[model samples]
Target: MFRLLIDADSFPLGKGPMVMLILFLISTIFIFARSEEQGQKLEFWIFANTHFEEYQTRVPIFEAENPGVNVQLINFGGTMHDKLLAAMLSNFGAPDLVEVEITSIGRFLKGAIDEVGFVDLRPRLESEGWMEKLVVSRFTPWSYRGRIYGIPHDLHPVVLLYRDDLFKAAGVEMTEVETWDDFIAAGKKATRDLDGDGTVDQHAIVLDRRTESDYFSLLLQQGGGFFDEEGNVIIDSELAIETLEFFVSLFNEHKIATPVYGTWHGDPSNFAAMQDGKILSILAPDWYVGILKSQVPQMAGKWKAISMPAWKPGDRRTTTRGGTMIGITTQCKNPDRAWELLKFTYFDRGGLVNRYETTRIIPPLKSAWDAPIFKEPDLYLGGQPLGELFIELAPDLPPRYQNPYWSEGADLLNDAIFAAVTEKQTSREALTELAAKVRALIAKDQGRWRDL
Candidate 1:
């Protein structure tokens, strides 16, 4: 009984119109059904392009394995943490998962642990035996009040990257340089005035007077840090004072290290210095290998890695530096699914292998250390099985703790280092002042959080 009208004309409904309507109905149903099949869409945010690319390759596999789930990766670069923080504060438009750099993680943990913007993954980590599988110390930077909030991405163990050719030519036997004393003695021999000028041209090491990383590395190597295991401010600890004095003495007293030109990583000037043989060695973490390979590819086979010299024999020769963690936001509606994706990306063996191959970054997963990819010789480092060396040093890496004011504390420590190194203040005086300032900041933070 249906009819159709056009302008002033009217006609009985035809089979063609009926067929068209039927097809439209079928197409609408099919569209919605396909949409339903697409299911949960997870928004993941990352700051690093390398990390983003790694996830892009794995997302398709995850989608195929998990029906009805899709992942959208967004790389916000340097603004990622700022945007994530704003979303967390405003409770709007947040990604289900995000990568938090170690330095930025402290800001998110300022509040009570239960109220943090990221989900507390401690239960899942313990229930699934992830705690045992991954290196425990790596979790420290991503945890607060004993509750872990993120999965560690890398081990980042520090090692000595030295010019093997230079050392051999200088007759400095690296094998005998097991302690800092021996290293200092060898460094004196390696330091030379290559151009016959009164000023020294080649130095044993590169120390950045402006940056905090090298200082932190040496401090952590000696079991000293800004805070104790109990989270108390210990910037002025006797151990820390000694470490600062020693760090300063490297350039001021020993005169064996050259001031870093720009930065030890990623800077063209530093790469040029290395290429020109102006510096003999650098304290590098696992991640630095990629930088060296990519930036100074011509240095292949000329450089080598060795365990860092200990303060004394029998001490830990490795220290941890920079790191990253992947975490699910508290705003995630389906934390279970997000957790699955997180585990797949960071914890799964296949995913870890893909990540290692892509980044050359040693995974915090202890079991993944034995992968064949890790055993393969690196031609860049004189065919050394660099991953194997990192694995040997992994268990001994010192733990680095996190506090809400960590960034501020680090800045203050840098200022203290500059003061002492420039003779504006003695190391003890500078560190003592720094400890007081850090304590005051911690107290202020406690009061603000208590109010919240």
Candidate 2:
């Protein structure tokens, strides 16, 4: 066995050169896997692909506090939804703890978890008095058939993320975009090049909202309402049609986001493209900035955020985007241990780790917002108190109209958006097709669409 003897002065003088040479040789192949599982096998499931490091710092703390419990974390990168669906069909998909995206929670609740493998978290929340503190409105997407099925973790509301330095260089007034019309105008002005370069140095904006007139749902503040109360697809409405035409106008008329840039070929994250400096402004969510800061640490203080653009002069300036739900599996052998992790992840330790320390997740607890840590100006946001602005917009969020059809509906919408943005089909024609497809999907699936 080899060990270290701490010698204050002579140790460094004797071992410094040797340590440096050893570090150089070992650095290339250094392998540090997560702590190994202990005696009891406890599986913890989450949809963490990029933020694995955040979980690293929490593991030792949790394991030390609660002995005799082993932890296993399952990460599903791009195939999370598809894999879960397959596992559900076989009755073998139950994880001790699972994280579901709120946007697609309706599908999991209706077909996979509600009457099947997942247990209701409401009882635990009520017994612990966490229900009152959690953001109720943030979790409406997970509610199906009038039952609370999931708990909120972080919410991604579409907002304005802009380059302030560019705005200043262009001599453009930086303020809240009054309406979509004004936003489109701002995109045109912001999409300019300086330094007399023949090629454009920066673009005006990038709108990555890909879905079947789905931007219509966000624009209309509806969750792509493919089925009505009577369960019939209503894509033929004038409001829906207007939504389609407006997306096309973004390319044909305004020329803000390029057809190629608006095209959905890869991830829509503002974090990915912001570093390349392709676009100057984007309509993004609150947590998006956090993702940027963590992944591309270089672009730390160059960005700022604003509320989503309004449809008209005085319309509401908010729309929902991303959020997460943590649930306990019915197959869990150690729910108490799982609950500890869930509670600690969402409610304990001053909410910094969940909101800040653990990466870019926004704490779902309302009280966390008012805390001194969250109230201060952040260096990443150019010393602006972005948390205050985010909380101010929280109450203004419209209740999400989520249903089982949301996931497939998102797929259909993605197709339509791609076709229109890439000029494979006109916006009107693509949305018309999307509306027709969604009607058929609803008719075949459960829900009131059967009668309609």
Candidate 3:
């Protein structure tokens, strides 16, 4: 049998070695004890590197202000939602907080409102008066059945990004363009055979034929969407048919728009087309500003933003596109602490301003709009106050409802649009078939989730 002595003078081993071992054990224990006492380990899962970086800068401030709190920021990239959805269903391995993109939010909103995996934020928003402080319509994508489950991260107000140089050279007056009709008239003049190659070399606008989001934006701009505020399918409504017809006409009849070699946002060819003066204008959301600056820096001072051409003389001039929301999960053990972190990251003015400065994304917090950064002129847009221009359209930004079937609905709508544009089916026929498919999906989803 071996015996250990705590008395240094009577120790069997050397006093120095015993003392060192004791110190190491004590330090190890102390470290673990301190970690336990640190309180509330909040795991925040984000998919975007930019968002992860932005929150990393703010986490230390939050930890310092609220002592003994720790935040673990994880960037899971594109597979985040799938992993999150799996965790939610299994009731295991879920993060304390998560950032859900607009397209992915609907998947988290299945079943009854109470059955949602994310905590319902409506009561807090109302009690704290945050509902009024933020852009009201910005909340629509994060809410279900009047219950908001997340805080909006951006306004995403859509605007027309036009080549001012091209418009001026083509003798088009932008101010006189109030409607889509006016826009098409201007496109006729702007679309020209600059190289005299017999075929028109320059198109007035860029609309991605492969992506449904472009058509969705036009639908939203005209006060139409896949689902109405009441959660009913409206993809085949008269307004939607009209919007789809106009979308098809842009490429088929007018021939003023062309699809880029790849996606409007990612492809190098799109930037080359812009540089070569082949594409004149694009419908850009606030976040697209960062993309343009990073991709086509040479187009500085040549581009200018304007309100989107309305469908009619007095219709809404802007629509919304991409958005993100941050929410606390129902699985969080320390929900109050999680909410504090969420509020600090999203509701606090300094955090919002820092996000805008870093990402060039317009915050939904209306109070933060008055920040000097928002008022500054963007050199890339010919010294135009780009932030102010987006803000101007923010109020009129239309609401985009959340439906559990939005993902499937969007794919079906894409197919419908493709059929119409390819002349295989009329716009009405395409949309009516799309509407039937969506209704069937809704019925199937309802049957699966009886509480919905």
Candidate 4:
């Protein structure tokens, strides 16, 4: 403390001051070198308009545990897709990690971009037996050319969310509904005009006419999707045509269901229908639970979630719908650390528990289901253990072929559905027409598309 500064003019030896200065510089460099080695840095970017805020709460735990790692979270929200596309096109500015929506993921999986854009996670994933741990079909949507590119954020297993009160009023017991035929009969019984108006006020179920969402849900459940295992279009197959016909019958022949033209589940009229007991049930995925809770809060305790009714008495009881996949981009500067962050967010049991507890987005990891939170009864579903039901249905999910042309293909299918239901075209007629249109579209870009 006497004198911290060294005076070169007053130094005893000629080289003493120079040696001391060098020593000080070396010490400073050593400290900085050690500091940098200890603090590994990672940069992450997510979609701007998405609800992944829980990551903000949970990432601190990851950083704290890693000690020398710093993960910088950048949220692009609304323009994330455009930015990500630009970054990929230029081969710059892409994030180490990204959250890609299921519908939009097909775009990223096509052509040269897929080869250079996203890392193949299979090597690391297989080492840990990651596929065996989660439902195997959960990998289907994120897979392209037999390579797994992303980890599933949630299973989004489809469930039939129904009004138990309405089921009771219709004299239909949940256990009694074993097959789709039984479901249709119950719907017929449930639908009636309470006020004796010419128009029936109540319907057994609701579907979207402008969208193939409900049709897609059921079609996937029936093991018929837009593409087959070999990447060939199979949407016009016998099973696919049959599934479409069944959906059409619900409205025209059975008269037990009604169609909404736009965003059916999110529509105000649909919410009012749910509130007024006009629509007793909806064919939706697990994420739709939060939508119901927020959009139709008064519906609490009156609803229940059950595995979707099977097409046959003992077929697979459920299928997957909407979900997101978190992937590691090939442009990652620190892929090892990036994988660590991704594994923690998606595959780690504790992280999954925290994710479900905070955001209520169910995890794809099966071990996470053992947590007490998953076991607790949801009061929103009349104390039914909906989590347990979702877990039970996870294993049986059919593999979905999400091809590059899926976006355009889905539109064609929706148009086909519209024709089948509204225009009263036979399922075969609608699908045959759809197949021709899809075939032509695919022929234009033969490499990116598969033949029907």
| Index of the highest-TM-score prediction | 3
* Candidate scoring better on TM-score of 2 and 4: 4
Candidate 1 accuracy as lDDT: 0.87
Question: What's the lDDT for all of these models?
Answer: 0.87, 0.65, 0.88, 0.81
Encode model 2's per-residue lDDT on 135-194: one tens digit a residue. 666656665555556677675556677888886677665575677777777777877655
lDDT of 1 at 280: 95
Q: Write the per-residue lDDT of candidate 4 for residues 1-452, one digit (tens) a residue.
A: 58537666666775676777779999999987864552277767777333457678778999999987888788887677778878888997788889887887877766753554889999989997787888778888988887888888888888888888878887888657878898989998888888887889888899887787888888999888988876788888999999888899999999988886246678887788788787888887777787777788788899987789998878999988788888888888778899989987778788777766654567888878888888789888989987788878887888887787888888778788998998668899999888878877777777554432
Off by over 4 Å in 2: 1-41, 49-52, 59-68, 79-83, 102-107, 110-114, 126-129, 193-201, 209-217, 220-236, 259-277, 334-337, 352-354, 422-428, 445-452
Write down the TM-score of every candidate.
Answer: 0.90, 0.76, 0.91, 0.87
The residue-by-residue lDDT of candidate 1 on 41-63, one tens digit each, is 88899999889999999889998
Q: How good is model 3 by TM-score?
A: 0.91
User: Is 2 or 3 the stronger prediction by lDDT?
Assistant: 3
Candidate 1 error regions (>4 Å):
1-39, 447-452
Error of 1 at 325 (Å): 0.2
Misplaced by over 4 Å in model 4 are 1-39, 48-51, 113-116, 447-452
lDDT score, candidate 1, position 190: 95
Per-prediction RMSD in angstroms?
5.7, 11.8, 5.0, 7.6
**Top-lDDT candidate index:** 3
